[model samples]
Target chain A: MATEITVGVGLIAIGASLAVGLTAVGTGMAEQAIGAAAVGAMAEKEELFGKGLIMTVIPESLVIFGLVVAILILNLVG
Target chain B: MLRPKQMLKLTIFGPKSYMKQVIEELYDMNAVHIEDYTKKSDDDVFDIGNPLSDNEKHSDTLVKIRSLISNLDIERKNILPRETSFETIEENVTKLHSKVSEVMAKKEYFTRIKEIYTKKEIKKALSSLRLRFDDEFDYTSAVYFIGFVNAEIAKLKEDVEKASKKNMTFDSHYNGVKAIAVFTDHKSKDDVEKVLEDYDFSPIDNPVVKEHFRDLTSAPGQRFVKLDHEVKAVSDKLKRVNDELSELKGENMIFLLSSEKKLTMEVEKGEAPLKFATTKNTFLLRGWVPRNKSKMLKKKVEDVSNSKVKMKFEVPGKHEEVPIEFDHPKMVEPFEAFMELYTLPSYKEIDPTFFMFLTFPIFFGFMLGDVGYGLVTLGLFLFLKMKMPGMKNFLNAFIIASISTIIFGMVFGEYFGFEFFPPAYGEHLVDSLPEHLINALHMHPMESHGALVYPFPHLFSRSHQISDLLSISVLFGIVHILIGLVVGFINIFENHGIVHALEEKGGWIMIMPLIVWLLLEPLGVITGHVYDMLASILPPLPVLGIMFAVGAILTIIGEGVVGVIEVMFLALMSNILSYARLMAVGLASLSLAAVVNDLSGQMIQSMGIIGIIPAAIIMILGHGINIALGILSPFLHSLRLHYVEFFGKFYGGGGKKYKSFGYSPK
Candidate 1:
């Protein structure tokens, strides 16, 4: 019997790729909306602009979530 | 804890009162009113019109005149005909004005006539007259000298005019009114009158008259007249004051106010509360004053209320001290603290914070179910919570989700989007694995040609199969509804009683699981070749009917027939569909990652190693972008499902938070 490659690598790779891809997409969309709102808010209230900008970037954690998955994929494949 | 308690109790007195004082100081102090101070009577007050800086000199002059008049004290004594009849004063003033006007007209005519005529002819005529009086005396100071000189000159002019008028044949009665020019030695009233009369020239010619004329023209004399005029003006004003004081007479002497009637009225009534009944012997009054003023105000209230009525002060908590108050009140502190882990947004009914915590990890783990991803997320949230104070909230929230993801990843049998668990810890955890299980569930992340799985797996390993998708969906559905039911029970029980919870939410709970289980079980009496596989699992016909009967009764008892119908229709549909999103998001993340890998893989192959580097970079970047999108999709969408689909079954919002005005930013 010709032994197949371990499906473990494939599952993890797919999972990680999904994790990274979905996270990046979700956060990017969220950031676009939130960033626009923050910029608008900043224009209105300059003092609160810094804080708003920071908070707008807060949802970017989704990207971090994706990056982690990508790193996991790299480690697993490597 | 110390800060939390302080947040709970608002300070009764402090900076707020000081702030009030600062405000008081900034604006006009006299403008604001204070209670308990009696306003003085304005009856005796003299209201000077708005005094400008220029009024300083005028005021000084007024003061000097006032002193001169007061020194005489005639007006104060009320001896100066106390009532100077306006009519008599008017008549005397009119007559005096006419006399002055007549004298002024005569002087103007003589002066102008002199300017018109020859100076030499006028001098010759004056000298001829002066030679008649005295060549030794100055012509300018002659007793009626100007009049005498003008008379001689006038006589000459009249003879000429008489000649001219006689020659022209006009009326001869135009010698102008016989007005005598006054030249007095004294400044006395009689001296001026005598000089004006045709008789009594002795008084006008007296040595005193000459001295008086000299005195009238002197600087001190002019100053004296000004002084007298000022004195008279001051005396007249003082008399007006006396008149006003008398006219201000009244029966009841209440304090007069210059401010608005309401505020001044409030001040006068001892700052009484709006609801106070003055008719009653004692009254109850309550109002908020600044914290700094609390002590002083309490003392004032005690003094006014005579210590009979009590005073209370309430100060609300500050944001930093009890930021949770910015959230909710009735929530138990620990729950509030837990909720605070997720922001307790003031506006939302459901604390989506908890929902975020519960759902984010599930979504994140499902999308990025690698042990490595979970660990990374966990570490990131933890570090953020520790290091960045501002991000501490987000960090804590994410950390909680990451932990959930880590746990869920283990259960899902996924590690880094892959199925590496069995190989990694095969002997220790799962003794065996299976054929259909690995292939269907495993997520391939490697770029290698192909991968296979070890055979013979346990039931848990088989839990994620495609056939079991419905069952998994049903299982999740039960959990979701149960959570909603639990929350409903908690909510109703908190507000109403347990009886309400049972009446409303209890029935659905009992009916849901029973219905699912009954449907899943086979219940067939047909004994045919095609039904052989399902027939073994079917309950006996008699028992099946009885089971149905019990379930029907329970469904009716737990939820009314209508409720049962609604729940069966709505809850089952919504709950099942809600789970669909989970699968959808999971698939979406997986598919996107797969596409990125495939695209980049093609690039790498076509371009060679150098080309592969760029392809690999693109893959990394593209996959990175997708991971971000994936993380949020599961997280927020899961929350949406929970908040809208689940929690709607059980939440009521609209509790008015307590707001105290004693301490505020103003």
Candidate 2:
């Protein structure tokens, strides 16, 4: 019973970590392209900074969603 | 407050002779946004009018004055603005231009002389060769080379002697790089050059001949000494010229600045007719005037033109794209910078500045909630406001945000990540309150007394009440999104009628109640028993599930299948979940502050008196970094929430901002 409980807890931790870690990686990948394009646009016209910042951070919601999923997973199972 | 100022389409036409007077009147009024007249290929009745007479004269004078201003570095703040007549400006400008230009020409001559003498390498080479300024080389029978060489002087001389087989004189010296001068007869020059080329010789110009100073009958050392004396004289003259220029600037600073202002206006007024459509005998101008100022504009134009002009005003048509001018109160004016940074609200849509003024700071404050950080930022912004008055509007917004941060800080019972009241004080305060009041406020007398304390007399401690904070963040998100949806509904309804509004925005509105219900149920604010009792009359899962279903169906019907996925999950669900950043960011800030405090405390405790240095350094550096991040992160997150989440729902921002004629931004 003890071993089973330990395994269950360990798996839950790994699952939670993966949920946040994979989404963060995905967010970074998405942001890389967006940040480059945003910088290019800003270089041409500096007034595009606000719009560029907005565009670059739009993909950030994916990581936040992943964080929410991780939080829910820990709360519900652990 | 909600919509842009109303504008009327105004057209004025008059005899061509009155064009100048009318334009002058309009410039003084500063109320018109003129529509530039374009001539269509097929239109032969009207063409763009020519600029007023003497336009070139005004333009020339303006350019001269602007150049003078730039050359003198005359800033507006250095000179007081006052009226100056056109005659005075014309006379003074020409006189100043000649005076300044003459001095400038003398300065340029001396600067060139100084440059020639400062070539130290050429001076060194000439001195080493013991060459005289007046030395004559017979071009017919002799040749000389003065340059740097990569090979040893002995080897180069030997190799050249062997190759040329003629008498030659070689002078060489090393100052970082080899400087060598070779003098040979013209017949042997080719053979000597061949050997020098193998040695990688790089030539230097003979400065005496290049500078046309070869007439001086003196050795290189004496010539350099004379040149140095001349350079000193030139430097003194340059200094005197600079002083004279500054003196001239001081005397005419006010005259020049005021003249610039007047001439600029003159030029603008003179060229104004070019924007008008004209026939052989008359000119026509079309523009927008604020509705309330139309009567005044009419009076001014008629008075100035002596009633020679005809004026007409008409309400804008429904399809017309009118320019937008914000009409916000002073308190809400600062937030307009955000709108300007993004895009202006379309003429027909509601302006979001007032709403942003209310909500943006709250979001910012919620994320950076700590009494110490708030007070620090508030003081910082206030200091900045005084130092950089030009950024008043931007600083004012942050000032308000910091105030909100203070309020949230009080609610969270945090002061620099420490509990506002220590445990002993908190216990005493909680005891003094009435028992029922304590119960009502849900006060707990004793708890952790470290950096994060959850005690009575204050609201939930941010660090301890994690779940509660998350729930409240989601609640704020729901309320914020509901407001966005309502605004969207109104916008669509105004433009496309209630049918489309109901189909598009109403679908989202219907789903919000279920979202709220789902959130409340988990927090134990509502239970299944209430819905279970209504289950007999309503359907299973009751009103909430039914509402969700209908909302889903309506969304699908309104936006098609793809939009259903977009509205339900992407827009509605993910956007709300994104607000979780509020809790996450604040928690991160608090945790960092706590870590800094704890680390410093441990350092001081374990290491005794000598540890104070490192501990203080750690505390200062750590809190400094945290505060810097605190300011930037919360501000960006709050802006993102409004721009991406809230504005995405309703705002269709691409309206033309109103720019009036003769209105210069200061």
Question: TM-score of every model?
Answer: 0.39, 0.80
Supply the DockQ value of model 2.
0.38
For this target, which candidate reaches the highest DockQ against the unseen true structure?
A: 2
How many angstroms is residue B84 displaced in model 2 relative to the true structure, after the best TM-score fit? 2.7
Clashes of each: 45, 0
Off by over 4 Å in 1: A1-78, B1-364, B375-391, B410-464, B467-470, B518-565, B598-608, B656-666
Candidate 1 per-residue lDDT over residues B579-602, each given as its tens digit: 544544555555565566667768
Query: Which residue window of length 10 is worst by lDDT in model 1 chain B?
Result: B251-260
Top TM-score prediction, candidate number: 2
- lDDT of candidate 2 over B83-140, digit per residue (tens): 6667777888998998888766555544544454465435544445554322454433
DockQ, 0 to 1 scale, candidate 1: 0.03
